[model samples]
Target: MIFVNAFLVGGAICVLGQILIDVFKLTPAHVVASFVVLGAVLDSFGIYDQLIQLAGAGATIPITSFGHALLHGAMSEGHEHGYLGIAIGIFKLTSAGITSAILFGFLTALIFKPKG
Candidate 1:
């Protein structure tokens, strides 16, 4: 049942992205940014946490989850450390993901040649 829920929810999110690209003619970058903002907004209202509870990996595996983690970390640390915590918390939850992206991108660039 959990697997079914995860599959359905994840597929629905992907379908929505496709609709944005095909019907609304948004570029992939625009769609990605929009989803991130949507996730942050939902988290601000505490709706995203509920969605995660219900959808599990379905909700956590998308780009939107990055936004959710950003806000969640910031809020959690902000309560303890005040203004500085906000800056610190922003990267705390996302540092691993960001680091891996940079590492892989660098490695790929080293291996591949770009068109002139």
Candidate 2:
């Protein structure tokens, strides 16, 4: 049930992005940035977390999720880190995901040589 809901929600978001790109001619970067901002605004209002609870990675894998992670990190760190919270906070929250991607990228690159 959870997986089904996540898949539907995540797929819908991705489909929306694809449509915007194809029909409206929005660039991927613009769509991504817009989604992040939208997510941040929604998160600040306490709506995004509830949505995430319902959708799981549906809400956590998109660029919007990145914004949410940053906001969550900042809020958590603000309790202890003061003004420096913003910068350090995002890093702390996203480090694991970032590290995993970097590691996987390095492994893939080592395994597959590219032609220039």
Candidate 3:
């Protein structure tokens, strides 16, 4: 049940991204950015919460989830520490992702040979 729902939801999201790229001729970067922004906007309106409850990691494992995590962090911290908390929240929530990305990228570059 839960696994099936997660697969269906995650598949749907991947299909949507593929459709956007194939039919609309959008760049992959554009599609990724659009999805993330959309997720953030949806979170602002509380729509994303329901989706998460319904889909679990299907909603939390995408690039959109990154945005949701960011917005959620900011909102939570903003309530406690005011405007400054927004920045702090973003940093706290996203730092792990950003750090891992940089670390892995650097490691991959070091391990692989680049073309001239």
lDDT of 3 by residue, 1-116 (tens): 77777898888989999999999999999999999998899999998888889889888888888888899989889999999999878756777888999999999999999879
User: Whole-model lDDT, candidate 1?
Assistant: 0.92
lDDT of 2 by residue, 1-116 (tens): 77987899899989989998999999999899988888888889998899789999888887788777778888888778887877678667778888999999999999998978
How far in Å is the alpha carbon of 56 misplaced in model 2? Answer: 1.3
Candidate 1's residue-wise lDDT over 33-78, tens digit each?
A: 9999998999999998998899899999888988999999999899
TM per model?
0.91, 0.85, 0.90
Model 1 — TM-score against the truth?
Answer: 0.91
Off by over 4 Å in 3: 114-116
| Candidate 3, position 46, lDDT | 90
RMSD of each: 1.9, 2.0, 1.8
How high is the CA lDDT of each candidate model?
0.92, 0.86, 0.89
If the candidates were sorted by their lDDT against the true structure, best first, what order would they fall in?
A: 1, 3, 2
Alpha carbon lDDT of residue 29, candidate 2? 93
Top candidate on lDDT is 1
Worst 10 residues of 2 by lDDT: 85-94
